[model samples]
Target: MSAPFLRGVEALAQFTAREGAGAAPARGHIERLLVDGEEHEHRLGIWYANTKQRRDKLNPAQRTALADLGVTWA
Candidate 1:
């Protein structure tokens, strides 16, 4: 299960790297990093301008939720 999950994450990471590298919005960014000591993986999405403008922006937990397929923000 972990192997397949990792593969999917790797694929998404690759796609994001190749496509989002140039097309990511100026105010936003997304990247993937191995987490939980590399046994687990996560994606990080950053909205710099939104954070700057909203001092009370939603916390990570509140701002993120698992999709139908079960991906979550880290």
Candidate 2:
């Protein structure tokens, strides 16, 4: 996977770990995660909303990955 997309997945994983599954983040939600020995911040909710909006555009692998993460709507 591309680095940025990987990071967003990491951010979502972290958010899920912290907030539990099925929690819909707010529009301004932010997730800070450690990835590749560095810290990165993801605009979690915005990314999520956008992902939902563009769900049909995601490739199978991307969709599968999100589904594996317990993202029901993915």
Candidate 3:
């Protein structure tokens, strides 16, 4: 991934860690990252799917965020 793409993912992770998972700001940041990183759809999709598989470990907000992004175990 490019620096900016990695930075966006890092920012999202940091925001979730600091603000608690699923915060609206964090979700919104993730949405922006998705849009900005559209060129990396395959990688993002893989990440999303992996996250979805770990949904049980995620907070409600985090799960919802992934869902909103179309991540699904099915």
Candidate 4:
């Protein structure tokens, strides 16, 4: 992947880690990652399922954002 894409994935991983710790994730940053990291749906879904609370925090708009990026949940 390109460097920016890799960076986005890194940011997403950090966000997921923070969320797992019960911290409020940086929403804008994570959204940007989700938007830019379009090819990472599987990774994103795995991260989404990493924490129940964090997963629950994804609102309808966020789910729409993910869907726009072609991310889908099974």
Candidate 5:
């Protein structure tokens, strides 16, 4: 397992677990990560998501939920 892969997975999981309210989309957006084994050439983006709904804009309730999830947006 690569560090990039692990970081990406961890971030994705945290984002999903908090964003997905049992019905939220399981799909994820594209993200990039870097590993120690390679140079800039080793950087890559992996798209991974497993939910039921698509994430668009957050509603008032959803925003509150996100805050509760410890996510502070600017």
Candidate 6:
């Protein structure tokens, strides 16, 4: 997977961790992550929407990751 892909997944995981189960982020939601000692922000809600729309293009691992985060559409 690409770095951006992993980062987006990581962002969602962090969002899920903080928001708890059965929570869906708002469309403008953003999540921040620290990688290699640097901080990055991900537009998590936008990413989730886009990912759900493009679900057919996602590989098995990607789908599984999202599903593990309790994403119903995944």
Estimate TM-scores for all models: 0.28, 0.86, 0.33, 0.31, 0.30, 0.89
The digit string of per-residue lDDT tens for model 6 on 46-74 reads 98888888999999898888899898888
Model 1, CA-based lDDT = 0.39
Q: What are the lDDT scores of the predictions, listed in order? A: 0.39, 0.82, 0.46, 0.44, 0.39, 0.86
Best by lDDT: 6
Model 2 lDDT per residue over 1-74, tens place: 66667777878888888888877778799998776798878898898888888889988888887887788977
TM-score of 2: 0.86
TM-score of candidate 3 on Cα atoms, chains taken together: 0.33
lDDT of 3: 0.46
- TM-score order, best first, reads 6, 2, 3, 4, 5, 1
Candidate whose TM-score is highest: 6
- The collision pairs in model 1 are none
Candidate 4 residue pairs in backbone clash: none
Residue 30's lDDT within candidate 2 is 91
Show model 3 residue runs off by greater than 4 Å.
1-42, 69-74
Q: What is the lDDT of candidate 5?
A: 0.39
Model 1: per-residue Cα lDDT at residue 29: 42
- Cα deviation at 23, candidate 5, in Å, is 9.0
- Tens digits of per-residue lDDT, candidate 5, 1-74, equal 44543454445445556566332223434423244664333111222231102224435654454445443440
lDDT of 3 at 11: 48
Candidate 4 has an lDDT of 0.44
Choose 2 or 5, whichever is better by lDDT.
2
Residue-by-residue lDDT tens digits, candidate 4, 15-62: 555565333333323333444556433343344444333546556655
Tell me the spans in candidate 2 whose CA falls farther than 4 Å from its real position: none
